[model samples]
Structures are given as structure tokens and as C-alpha cells.
Target: MTVDNIYDVVIVGSGAAGLTAAITAKKNGLSVVVLEKAPVFGGTTAFSGGVAWIPGNPHFQDRPDAEGGTRVDRAAVHDYMRHEAGNKYDAAFVDAYLDYGPKMLRFMERETEVEFTPSLYPDYHPEAPGGAQIGRSVTAAAYDGRRLGKEFKRLRQPLKTITFMGMMFNSSNNDLKHFFNFTRSPVSAAYVAKRLAVHIAHLARYGRGVQLTSGNALAARLAKSALDLGIEIVTEAPVAELLHQDGRVGGVVASIDGQRREIRAARGVVLAAGGFARDLARIKALYPHVREGGEHFTPVPEGNTGDGIALGERAGGHLSQGLPNSAAWMPVSKVPFPGGAIAFPHLVDRYKPGFIMVNPAGRRFVNESHSYHDVGAAMIETCRGLGRTEAWLIADHRTIRKYGIGFVKPYPMPLGPHIRNGYLRRGKTIQDLARQIGVDPETLAKEVETYNDSARRGEDRQFGRGSSAFNRYLGDANHKPNPNVAPVENGPFYALHIVMGDLGTFPGLVTDTQARVLDGDGTPIPGLYAAGNDAASIMGGAYPGAGITIGPAMTFGYVAGLSLAGRIADHRAGQAAE
Candidate 1:
């Protein structure tokens, strides 16, 4: 029962990538160990909305005809991603990913007990010329961490509550329908009854149910499988340094319970310790405009502070600059959580009509309904010469009363205490509001008038506001003329200041297609690999689909595991032959 001094593979950060690597290596009969920096396993993966974009998946092809049964063309997916990334993506890495992603998913499905289902959610770039509606996203079925027995304590449950059985349980428009129904009709009663019955059945039998969302489900299932394979996950063990011999990784120096321990990796070591979002100083240094003071908006975990990147750099690894483009950006309301903050789901759906956002010069900018990336890019662009980066969401009485602006209930309340105390402004007229927010009152009034005219005509000629399907999908369906093209007609307006907030920093150690960490010369460091946010992202600068970070993390980790273990076996055989 003595603890082995060396393992075949040592994986740092027991998130999706680390766990996936451990499981794959163990399956190949290689002794593996995982070290997690946080108190629990499953880093940010558990908190994400899981939707892996797996092109050419078989399950999609096996779906019913009405559900659109057919494999996604590899070429179409590649072209779509290239166009989405604006040709900034690494062609070789992306091609390798597209070729192997489906195969990796299939391998995990066939070899392990993890189960997955296709999601009907369209690609985020569904309208990008080559984008399609169905067959693009896949999610794991809910797994009972309880199945891991003692290992359950080591796994991290989602920081938020998750819905079971692919049920319309997460933040979706369906939540609104359910709320209205619960308050107004008996149909809601019947629907609740059926949903409750299904939950009960799943709890009594499988110990878990599917979720309408995919991220949480995927993390739980991966954790369960890793535990079942006897992979040892040591929590609160942060890898501080990589042990090397002749320019190759030999082991790792890890901190466990404040005590340092050296765990040798006879075969290799993998770094998946995530990114530097929580580190305020690093963020300001790298991305100055996106400051960390004012109102709270980031949903990222506090522990994600670039431990992996630091360790890799200490070991002479190269880092990528534009990789920060992989960061997750969002427009969040000023709702305060205990240690962090979260975007109120209602605000996203509510802030459509009677509101328009403007830059410091008081001019309408990009489409208000564009994805957060485009929004963040626009914010950065608008504030290019302003000496600071900031924007304002202008809304009037109509929007306040109709959709409920803040996180507080009944919505019409003028900027809750959180917003008012932090970064929000209110006034009786557009000019007054502009003055208070430090914008040109005349320009602000003119922008509002122009927007109102467009709203009256049921069109946005400036930005094609309602043109994209993705924009309209998240728009207020109750609006007339167009769901996304509403004007600022009502007076007694309010404007809330907004800055670009990110989930985590995405720039990190550069890695090859096999997830092997590379050195300054652009050569892979033998016996060293990285995955997830800890490594240079495979998506290059674009966020193509939901769970892009976790999906590639898991995929590349699987590949790294197989490659490393095979090398170990080959080494042993060669030694025997000698």
C-alpha cells in the first residue's frame, strides 16, 4: 500500500482536461495521478453551459428525420470556423482538431461509461455562411457523482444549481414561459407535474437526470469516469514548478496542504491549471481598459489565476499574445454574489426595447444584440482615443416598466442600490442624462432621435441590429416591428455604465496539436504538455460555440494521454530490447 514514488503521467489541474488525460492514460494501462490546485476537482468546467461543437458526430446522423439526421461536413465546419476567426486561426491545428474531435468523442463514448446526447442548439456562428442549425453541438447526460463513492467529496459540484434531464432548466426563454404559465394557467401545473415525475424517476433509478444545459453534465460525467478508473485526484495540490532533465520534463514540484512534495512523472506531465482572470494586476497589465474596480460582473472562479502559465513559463515555455481572445466576455448586471458576481439572466432578455447603447461621444456603435465578443471588441474600438474604456446602456421609462431593468424584482425600479452606488446614471431628459454620464448632451439627444426614427420604421439601417438570427434569438420576442430594433422613445431615461468583463484570461503556454507544451524555439518540450485555458487555445482568437474551452481541453487531453502513454510503452520495450 506504499505510495509510488513515480507515476507514468502526472496531470495538473483536475478539470476536464486533466481528468480526461488521466482516464485516457489509465485506460492505456499507464499509472496516472492528477493534482488540483483548488479544494475540489472540476475547475470552471462544472460552472459552464456545456455545448461541445463536435462536427461529423454519429449521434447527429442517427437522429430522427424530423430532427435533421445527417453528419456535419468537416469542410463546412472548418470554413465556418475560419471565417468566424477572421482567418486568424492556425490552419494546421484547426484541421487536426476537426479531423480528430469526432473520433475522440466516439472513442470516449465507446470505451468509457460516459453517455452523451446531441443538443438542438445552433452554432453561435450558425449564420456564418457555412453554419448549420442542428448536428453541431453535443452534451453529456447527467451523471451521479455519488457513483464515485468516496471520490464524490473530491469532485466539484457546480457553483450554481443545475436542471436535470436536458429539461428547460437553465437560463433560457423557456424560463420566462414557465414563469408566466405558473402565474397564469393550469397548463403550467400539468407541465410541472410531468417534469417532477421525470425527476423522481431519474433520482430513484440512475441517481441523476439529464440537463437542458451541457457543461455541468459533461464535467460530472468525466469526473465519475476518471474516479472509476482508479485515477488519483489530489486536491489543493498546486503545481509550482516542472522538474526537468536535459530539457525534458521529469516530474513536478507541487504544494499539498501548504507542504511541498515532488511527484516524479516517469513518462510525462500535463498542465491544465486554467487562466489568469482573477488576478487584477495581471489583467490590468495585459488588458488595461477592462479594469476590475467598479461594479462586480465576472462569473469566473477566484482560483483561476494563471498558475499553469506561470509554471510553464518558469520551465522555458513560449506564450501566445492574441490567445487572450479566447476569454469569455458578457454583459452583466450589478448583482453581488458572496465571493464573485454573476449576470442576472433576466436582464439579458429584458434590456431590449426602449434602450440603446452609445459610446463616449454619444454615438450609436455596433449592434447592441451582437455576441459578447463583438460587443467587447466594439467597446474597445469606441474608447480607442477616449483615454479610457467605457460605454452606457440608455433606457427610458417604457423599458423600465415593461421589461424590468435591474436584478431586483418587478424590474421598473430605478437602478438598484448596487448599480446606483457603483456605475449608473439617471436623469429626466436625454441631455441631462448625457451631462451626468460625461457625454455630449446634443450628440446623445441626436442619437436617440435617430434611433427612435429607425424603431418607428421597424429597421436599424446603421448596424443591421435585427438582421442576424443569433441576435434575434436572444432578443425580446414580445417587441413589435422587430425584436432587436427598438428605439429610445420614452423619456425620464437611465444609463448604466458597462465595461468589458471576462470569465478568465485565455493567453497561455503554446502547445502543438498533441497538446505538448512548446518552448521558445517553437519546438515541443518532450514529456511536457498542456490543455484547456492553461494552453494556447486551439480555436485561435474566436469563440465558435458554447463550451469551446472545455471541449478542446478534454479533446486535446485525451490525445496527449494516448501519445504520452504510448511513448512510455515504446521506451520500456526499447530498453528490454537493448
Candidate 2:
């Protein structure tokens, strides 16, 4: 098929936001095309957990009594936002997300074939205003790749940390439990039995299983729906330069197979390129501590190296800063998975009983059981003048065996491999383990004593670790009093060094609530738009829930489509009158 000379909407980056923008614009009566830089479609969203935090969704409001679906209160949400972002809160931006998010979601569901199932995962700050313990986070239902026929293999697979045997994929709680806890319960056994049977049959027929869920499912479903609608997706076409007309962005100069081609757009170009995480230069500029054992810990994909940001800025778009950090941080640990080295985000690992995080000084700084973002923020804050860049996560025998610590599998799973690889440190005594990790042995012993006492009492007085609802949700349910605390007085302890791993870039192009890119002077640059990490988060850099990132990305992408499409409609009306 020949590439079109002009499109109504030319979307840069085929991640959730770009795909969403292309889909919405196409449905809204605009000829759309998605430009993907990577050979495969779907950016980091395909590798993500795919929980979208969309409060006040119509799907949840309709179900009411559904597990993760329920009506959300607007006032409560406002309260949470105000408290989270304080005076820096973008009320109009957030209001735009809240007002249009549900409509966008409903529109996609009705018009497109994409499906979302309510996820039982709680918000990062469930105690915050309007936070729903459940309901808000919605995950994409499993997608049968077989439906895509020959296109199934073209879809990007899940990250190695997510799959088993590099062929099986799980996207939700029940699915993961069935796969990971295969021999634990009868239900799990049955689930695995069917999965194995299907795996064997599929391996024989297709060499890979087609049961896709979570982020992979979401991206695949969007791609399938877009393909079905005849939207031309040009892969391996990276946007080199945005076409400009009198200080306005009209299209993009894309690199297609090592050759540069100018792609035109009638309405505008939406910059949804992932982020600047992979760019070492940007990372050094953002976090001055980059050289100090930081990027060695970062597992972000190398593709997201600020292409969108550079294009937007060259077009006079301004970058937003000063909310939290330049990027959304997550406590990450590296481990060797099947295909390659995997950066496993440490969320559940921190909240479970018998795990504690300590700095190089061997002192517990933040509540280990808190949100991953919060923990990472604390890690950064704690290391400001402490001469330490990373923290160590100490796990006792029970924590490592019962609930795997980071990359370490449970009791039945051997840790010898991990220990041998130096991904984990083990010792019969706390002092010995401390020496292995370069922490003060005396201070380590004291920290353990203090933590063990708190665990026995079922309370964390130092940092209030297990006091929150969110903490308890991620904690071990079997534990009494506090599910987040357990005595660390067991022999054969394990320790893993944790680093501040960012999920996606937090701050990017500054845009108005309409998803129009704003200039350095705070003026909206015509024909320019941005969403997802390519745009400064509408939440002003504070994470609220599981899918908060994806929710806004898709919503604003929807908003950008509607806005630009309307502009197209208006232009046509004016031309007709003329």
C-alpha cells in the first residue's frame, strides 16, 4: 500500500496515547494514520501491567455492585487531587480528565472492539480523597490473538518479567495466581492444567499461546480495532521533525527504513512518543545523580529517548517542571529472566511481611510497605545528602520462601541461582549479610532488632509502614494484626539492592486542558497537541492509581482527536461557506 500524502490527523508514537488518538480521530470523521518509530507497535504500555485508573467511569457506575466497578464521587476525587498536588494542582486539567474520561471510555467501548474489565487493585493512595479501594482501576480483558489471524505474531509480546516459559502471559490477579501458584490450590491446578493443555496445543500449531491480557491485551485490541477500521499504521517510521507552518505544527518528517519522508496532516500532529527515560543526556540533566549507580539500575526501554519532546520544543512547546520529579519513579530490582535481564518493579515485594528497605547507613528511611512511587520518592529524598544512591531490601527466610522477594522465588523455588548471580545477598547472620552489601554491620543489626520488635507488636512506629489501607492491601493477608509486618529473626536472610527506577517520564510538553501544546509564554501553539508521557501529566506529576498513566494518555488522546477533528470540521464548514 502506498503512503498517503496527507492525513486529517497524523499521530506520532503508537503507544496507548498515539493509538488512542488515531482511533478516536478516525472515528470522529477524520482520516487518521499512526506513525510508529519502533518495528513493533505498542510502546511500554505493552510491557506494563495495564491497570488504568479512571475514576467515575461509566462502566463502573453502571455495574455498581461489580467487584472493581462502582460509582465514584467527584468531590472526593477533587479532595484527593487538591491534597496530592496542593496549590500546583491543575483543577481544569483534572476536571477535563474526570468529565471526559468516562465519555471517552464509553465511546471507545461502543465504537471500538476494545473491552475493559474492572481490576480489584486499589489506588496507590486509597486513603486519599475519593480513592476507591477497588472499582477505579480497569484492566483490558484477555485478547484472543487468534482473532487477529496472521497479524497475531506482529503484536508486541509482554515483558519477560511478566511471562512464563517466554510463551505464556498473564495480565490479572486471578490469571497470575493460577500461573504462579499452580500447585497451591485446586482452582489454580485446574487453571494451570487448562493453560498447559492449551499451551501444548498452541505450541504445536502456532509456536506461541494466543491468550493475551493486561497491557498486551489492551494494546493488541486497540491495534486490531484500528486495523479493522482501515487506519494505515506505518511501523519503523520515527518522527524526525514536525512539519511547521508559521509557528504551527501541521505534520511530521518521519524516518521510514533509514530514509526520511515528510508526512502531512490537515489538522495537527499529536506527540505521544514514550518519554526521555532512555536518553542518558536527559537523565543526567533531570537527575544529577545519574552517574552515581543510577542508570545501571534503570530498565527503561531505549526507544524512548525524547524524540517527541525535542520536536515539541523545536515547535515552541514548553516543558513543565517542579511537581515531584521529572519522571514517575518506581522501586526496581534487576534479575535475569528468560529472554534477557528484567527490571522487576518491586511493589508487592515491599509490602509483604518480613521485608524492609534500608539505606547504605543501614537505617530504614521510608515505609517499605507504601506505594512504589512514594517509596521511590523517599529513596531519592533520603539519598539527597546521605552519600547513597540505592537502598537494600532485606528479606528473611519466611519472606523469601513464602512470598518471593523481588526476583527471588518462594521457598520451593531455589535462591542459589540468584545468589550466585549476585542479584541477591544471603547470610546466616544479619551482620554477615550487611557486610556483603557494604552496610554498617552494627547499624544493620540494630535496624533488624527494631524492625523485628515492630513486627511482633504488629505496628511500625518509625515510618507507619503498615498503617494504611493500601499497604494492607498489598501486604500478606495471612499475617495477623498487620499484614505488612513480620519478625525478621529467621536465619538464611536475603537482601536485594533496590534502585529508583522510573516507570515513564513525568514532566513533558506543557499543554492546555484541550490537549493543545502550549508555548514557553503559555500560549497554545496551533496545530500542535500532545498526550501520555509526551505531555506533562494532567495530574501535575502525582500518581493516583494503577492505570493513572494510561487513563490520562488515552483520555487526552481522545480529547486531542475530538479537538483537532472539530477544527477540521469547522475548517470544512468555513470553506464550504466561502
For all predicted structures, in order, the TM-scores are 0.82, 0.92
The worst-scoring run of ten residues by lDDT in candidate 1 lies at: 569-578
All models: lDDT?
A: 0.68, 0.79
List residue ranges in candidate 1 displaced over 4 A.
1-4, 62-70, 111-116, 140-177, 180-214, 245-247, 280-282, 288-297, 322-326, 337-347, 350-355, 396-442, 477-481, 490-494, 567-578
Q: What would the C-alpha RMSD of candidate 1 be, to one decimal place?
A: 5.8
lDDT of 1 by residue, 1-578 (tens): 13356898999887778888888888888999888888887787776655566666656875433423345465787788777766456766766666556666877787786667766656666788678765666776656455666665555555442222323354344544443344345886577667768767755765554332345556667777786787778888878889986768989988876878888998899988877777666676666454423322455666888888888888878778754364666555444556655443222532365667788789988788776666766777777755666677778766655554544322323455745465446788999999988899999998888888878877887877777666666676667768777767677787776656665556778987778888899887888888888887766667676557766877788778877877322221322110
What is the C-alpha RMSD, rounded to one decimal, of candidate 2? 3.9
Pairs that clash in candidate 1? 50-214, 50-215, 164-210, 165-210, 166-210, 166-211, 166-212, 404-411
Return the clash pairs for model 2, or none.
51-547, 52-547, 53-547, 68-135, 401-411
